[model samples]
Target: MNKLWGFIVAYFLRWFPHGLEPGLRRIGNPGPESPVLVSGNFSLTLKRLIRSLVGQDLWLLVANSRGINVWCAAVGGMFTHHNVIAAIKTSGLADQVRHREVILPQLCAAGMDVKAIREEAGFQVRFGPVRAEDLPAYLAQGKKKTDAMSRFRFDLRHRLDMLLSNNTMFYLIVAIPLAIFWPHRLLAFTLLFWAAAFYLYLLFPYLPGKTGWSRSLYSALAVVLAIPAADFFRAGQPFLHYGWMIAVVLVFSTVGFDAAGILAAMPSDAEAFLHRLGIKRLGSLLQEKTLGRVALDREKCRGDMICYSICPVGVFGELDPDKKITLPWQNACFACGACVKQCPHDALSLQPRP
Candidate 1:
């Protein structure tokens, strides 16, 4: 029953921080030579990691990322070099581990300063595979990550998971009041919202837009159009009520706007477009300036292809194997800093558009 409840409330749990007890945890029976893995203190993330390492002998260092998962926490700036260093020191890891190396989730690379952590914490940080499930293989393979393991995927199952995480709370909040006051309208809107969300998630790749904002606007417009068309079937009655249309439009637009974060991959241009729209609605103005773009230092680039594989968008292209790489679609760069951090040779940097 406890497991069932945890599964049911998983979506609600993602919104806030959980499992904030930051310290060192001994997983299984570990000697001083056992591997030490570090991760965020998000309860679910910790739980998942624990389950994955059920039989493995190791030490787990839980860092306070304000209860956020490693990826999101790092991107939001909550997970940083300070958090990792604090965890290392406060947990007294030095006394327990014989080696001076710690493994962090690869996704955390974007937010964490690896060099700073090593310099301050006195431990070399190695990034593990992107998924916790692959930890055993990664460890067994001498801590080497393959291109497939490093790549981030947004397949159908992942999209469904994202849809639930993003929309479950909104549905519950809106459904309760309507269910209490107007059960009929509650059912109608519930179905509407569910359908709209499914459309957004399932058809996201095919959505006719370059940016998240544009795709969301297009999807919202479809929902708005469907309402009037459905009403039209009721002949001899008003096909479209102005007030109802306005309410539907507002709800759809509000939900769609969330695509800025919920969408599997968002480009930098889309983020800028959403920011402009958000600021303008408050009766303010934004003087547009060219934002920074990712720049490659050819001399420093080892042509390791890590950047090409890890980039969410296909920003970097290979000109020659292990020799040359070119930025064909530099404009699509989201500046997530994943490539910059993962690059072994310090070949990549973000430079402001001049």
Candidate 2:
């Protein structure tokens, strides 16, 4: 029953950032020589990490990230060098561990500065595998990450997981107002919204568009067309039929805009695309472009390949032994700042695009 309740809440009320207490936690009765791993204070993430490390003897340092997952918190600037240092200092981890190394989740590389952490807290940060499930194998392999473990894949499972986790909050917030104000159309709207969501997620890769916004908009249009087609088949009054159709289109289009924000690799561009669609009344969908082009200072680069392994998107090219890091496709950069933050020599920076 507890598990059932957690599942429902995770799917429905996940927007609320439920966080755990920030401190050092001993997993499986670890001693001073045990490996130390650090993560954000998101409740679900903590639970998953605990489950993954059930039999392992290690130290877990939980940093305050306002209850957001590592990747989102890192990208949103909630998880950073300061948070890591705070966790280390507050937890008294320096006195507990003999080794100076701490394992951080690979996703946190976007915002976490290894140099800053080493300077402030006296700990060397080593990035772990992308997923917690791979931690056992990662440890067994002497903490060596395979290429597949480092790379981020947005496959069907990942897309569906993201869809369910994100839509849970959307449903709770939108469902109440919809039932209270437009009770007559509540069921229709709810069903249409979910149907459009599934279509967009399931057909994400094959959807006809260059950008996430375009693909979601196309999917929303496909679902919205059914309303008019149904009206035509029933030979309903034109005024009533078109009015209902307009309402449905407006609601679905708004949802499409929301989906664009969640599913798009570059959310700022998605917002711009929605603006082009004449959507001006979006309450929270307006994300301004704060990060510009990711720049590499070749003279400072040491060719460490840390950025190459950490980037979720293939933004950085393969590192040649003789050449510095090259930006072959800067347009594909998501501006997560992982490469910039993890660069050992501080060779990478984000410059405002001209």
Candidate 3:
């Protein structure tokens, strides 16, 4: 009965026309002696991780992370000491767990200060495997992660889930039109979904292009060109009539391109390429940090918090009564140039890091 309800909920969530966000789960509880595992409350991560640990007798200490996954939330600074401490205190985790330790994903180290967490809260943070699947093995083997467990891999199965599950809205809406008008369209759509899914998932690393976008555009163009040729030979018709097929090919192919951002693995190949390009440009611009620092001269800052508001990284802090604001934690800047754009007086300059 419980499994049935869970399936229903998952399906309803997939079909529902709403944006995905993380939230806390009020789930079944385990005894104090049961090991407590910590994770972000991102709905997708929590649901899948909990599903993976279905048979285990454990307590999940889901920290409120504003719906971000563990690694992302940590790096983005939303899943911080305040959130962890607040979760522990507010969730009454002390009363539910016998041990003074909680297992957290290793990737979370970037955002979280483990030492601070320990000092503020008595609970010692235990680093687990990078992926949640290693939890059972690590837990069984007395809390040690094997090197194999820590390494990240974007296998075919992971890609399929991300591509299909993340943009389920696209599928569902497309399906309705096909079902009503193009009754024979369902099979073609399915094949297109899985084929592009497999290609993006399995062949993305080897795809013959620089960026995922470039790869996608070229691949799409090739298919678009070939479809008319195929149609010409099949129906003995001109390419003009089959222009719709080219549109179809382009649409599906570019969907995979867009999926690269959200579906691909961390430090995603697509993102990595962009990062590499950005790093090169920044390195050239800074000239070894010899220029002025990229900072707010408080005298020039109007307490408008434009830098704080426009930063994609959530790096800037609110202005205090003393007209002071803070930058990201040391060395945490991604150098996206958003702050520089937001500065009205050109006060925020990209100075070399000292």
Candidate 4:
């Protein structure tokens, strides 16, 4: 029963807040024979990966990536060397696993520098296939990845998962409210929103050549046309009512805002749309005085810029001639913890605002 509820929660998180990571299987004792595999902590991905390794015996190291799935966290630069190190240290990997080596997911390579992790953490890193399903065959054939294992795929099931994750918040917070308050008019509007969400989710990959702007505009226009038609068809009484028109506009506009978040190519595009709709401000907020400070233990730093370069907000500055990293624009820190992931010495990290 507990496991059943956990899976339900995991399914919902596929489109809402992130899910838990799967557990690791320590293959062999402290020896050269044991192969240690690393992966993200996304509950769904972890489950899929572990399920793939059912027949094999291996050590799986699950990194803490804020519950985000592997590819997303890697591209976002969250699952880097420091994070791997932190996981290793906290998990007591050194004492448990005899070999000083770790196998990483190939998809995560972009976010990590193999040489850096090897040098700083004293562990050799090996990259495995893009998907976990191929691991058993790859391992059987002298631990190698076949061409099939290296490929990345995005099929119907994958698209639907993304669709659900993107609009879970919308269905819960927005859809439910409208349905409860204005059941009659909102009923048609709600149906239209789900139809649009599902349609866009499925059709997005094949859409004609266009930018996010063009796509969003087309979607907005479609919502504008369809909701009114839907309302008229649903209502039998006097159709051209002013209140009805207002409700239609409200519903369409809300759907547009939701679409921007789901469909925008860049986070900035979503921000712009939300701002235009007066949904919320787009800029990141920090308690100005509290956020800019990075506590650096100079004595502890090994001159690793894991935190220096991976900053999405450009908060970390360039390395000095003496090789010391400087954060001249420390005020820019949103405190996202990118540096903490890169710092091998565990020297640089965010301190709570006093």
Candidate 5:
């Protein structure tokens, strides 16, 4: 019951930070020679790491990331060299480990400064695979990551997972108040909400483009078609059909806007809209971070290859092939600003596109 309840909270209220104490934990019979790994204090992330790397003899260092998962925390500037430094120094990890190196999650490459962590914490940072499940293979191969391990995935399972886990809370919140006041339309609202969200999610990959316009257009199209379909099924109930049409539109308005925050690598339309309205983000994913362009100065490119290794998307290509940084898959840039943050040579810059 407790584990099930934990999953319910982790899945539903994940929008809020669920922090664990920042400290060191031993997995199995970890010794001084065992590998030391690091992650944020987000409870779910740690649980997954423990579950994935179970039976491994290692030390896990939990850093203070304001309870955010590694990718989000690192990109948002909460998880960094500073947090790792604190975790290492305060956790007394040095005495417990024989080596001077620690493995961080690869997704944190967006903000974690490898050099800084090395200099300050006296620990070399080797970024691990993108997913926790890949950790065993990563460790098995002497911590060498393959191309498959570096690139993040956005398949149907991940897309639907985000739909079910992240945004379901928003729907519940919206529905409850309406359920209290307009109790008669509760069922209609529920049906419309799921229908709109589900249809969009099912066809998310086939959506026209990676822009807010495509989503908004498809959302309107879905609601528009839904009225006719509902009417066709109930030819005599014209009044009921119109009522549902209105309900569908109302529910879909929030759904499309809400989708701006989902798993697609596209920039958040909701954030951009809020930014235009003179509202600022609460120090999370800044709208400018996504709206701005990331430019690389080849002259400043010392061929350090941090950008090549750090990009969650396969935006940067392998350095060995060109002996220089390349953006072969540039359009796939999620604009998380990870490479820009960790660029030792200051070669990459992010600015609003003119």
Candidate 6:
């Protein structure tokens, strides 16, 4: 793939599902004993993962995900165990590898049926680190994914990347209407969006509220109040800046509201809110949670720490000396069910809110 072209498409046009061919790809040189991995056919995910897999001898089974990323595809029912089974059966990976172990991305835990995959494909599924970059270190450390690897970080760089990707289409579509009607404000509109987006994403962590929607309201309030402040600074002159205030409020509201969807931790908050407003078809896609609080069964506990190891929000506390688990961060769970799904002993569960 042309690296530049791949980068452009992945960032700019990701809203559209685009893909590379699905099949088995070899990284470095692989033998029959090499480790096996799985990924979706999304071009960007493929590009990033290939970089992480370089200089390693392994088999990457690219499953068909309708050109979407693994996490989205899995939850959407496109990259189920059936996809893995088909890839394994058709790609001749079983014949090529002696081991039946496949390191699937951990984010797909909500959608993948580990037992079903093993039963159908004869491959034991081991969910890998949440991010592709951790793969190299996870492999180096004898295929162990550290707790740090499972946690998600919306750092400045990644947040900026998300800002660019999420807003590219929004701007592209909005730019035309602005240019046609409000030609003079077009530059101002573009600048305002960039400014609001950068402020919201860059300062996301420091912003108040557990959910992105909540955090956005504060930002929108600030923007709404800024127009009066500007007037105050202009020696009490009436600037009639209400239009710009309205613009800023809308921009901040739009950016902040979207923060929930783009952000890993708050992915469900906005969607759930929208769902409550009766957009069931769209909101239920990823945000609606039928399950409630996550609970652990003490009698069945093996303390394998699978739940602790796989949680993106660090809800499951550290393992106890007696090999039991704790839920010190219970409120953080978005009900994605990664822990419940990956728990080996069936000890973890989701309890309805009381």
Best model per lDDT: 6
Please report how far candidate 2 places residue 350 from its true position, in Å. Answer: 3.2
The alpha-carbon deviation from the true structure for residue 294 of candidate 6, after best TM-score superposition, in angstroms, is 2.5
For model 3, name the residue pairs that clash: 22-67, 74-111, 289-352, 292-351, 294-351
* Candidate 6: regions farther than 4 A off: 1-8, 232-239, 278-293, 320-322, 351-354
What does candidate 5 score on TM?
Answer: 0.89
lDDT of 3 by residue, 228-339 (tens): 7877888876586465566556555545544444444211333344444554221101111112225667767777665554443345666777776766542334443445
Tens-digit per-residue lDDT, 303-344, candidate 4: 666554345444556677767777786654444344564466
lDDT of 4 at 33: 55
Residue 98 of model 3, lDDT score: 75
In the predicted model 1, the residue pairs found to clash are: none
For residue 39, what is the lDDT in candidate 6? 91
lDDT of each: 0.73, 0.75, 0.59, 0.60, 0.76, 0.79
lDDT tens digits, residues 164-245, model 5?
6665776889889988998887787787678777877767667765675466566666667866777768785435566565
- Output the worst ten-in-a-row residue range by lDDT, candidate 1: 280-289
TM-scores of the candidates in the order shown: 0.82, 0.85, 0.60, 0.62, 0.89, 0.90
Please provide, for model 6 over 184-235, each residue's C-alpha lDDT reduced to its tens digit, 9 standing for 90 to 100.
9799899998988888888888888777877877887877787788888886
Using lDDT as the measure, what is the rank order of every candidate, best first?
Answer: 6, 5, 2, 1, 4, 3
Q: Evaluate model 2: give its lDDT.
A: 0.75
Alpha-carbon error at 201 in model 1, in Å? 1.5
Model 1 lDDT per residue over 218-265, tens place: 777775676667777765344456566665665555456556445555
On residues 1-354, what C-alpha lDDT tens digit does candidate 2 reach at each position? 966765565554555566778999999989998999999988787898899998999999999987778887777677898999999998899899898999999988888878889999999989999989889899989999987888677678777876767665666577789798989867876886687677776777777877666776666567567767777677863344666566556655555554544554543554455446765433222423335668888889888787888876667887666678777777666677788877878898888666
**TM-score of model number 3:** 0.60
Kindly provide the TM-score of model 6 when superposed on the true structure, using C-alpha atoms.
Answer: 0.90
User: In angstroms, how far off is 28's CA in candidate 1?
Assistant: 2.4
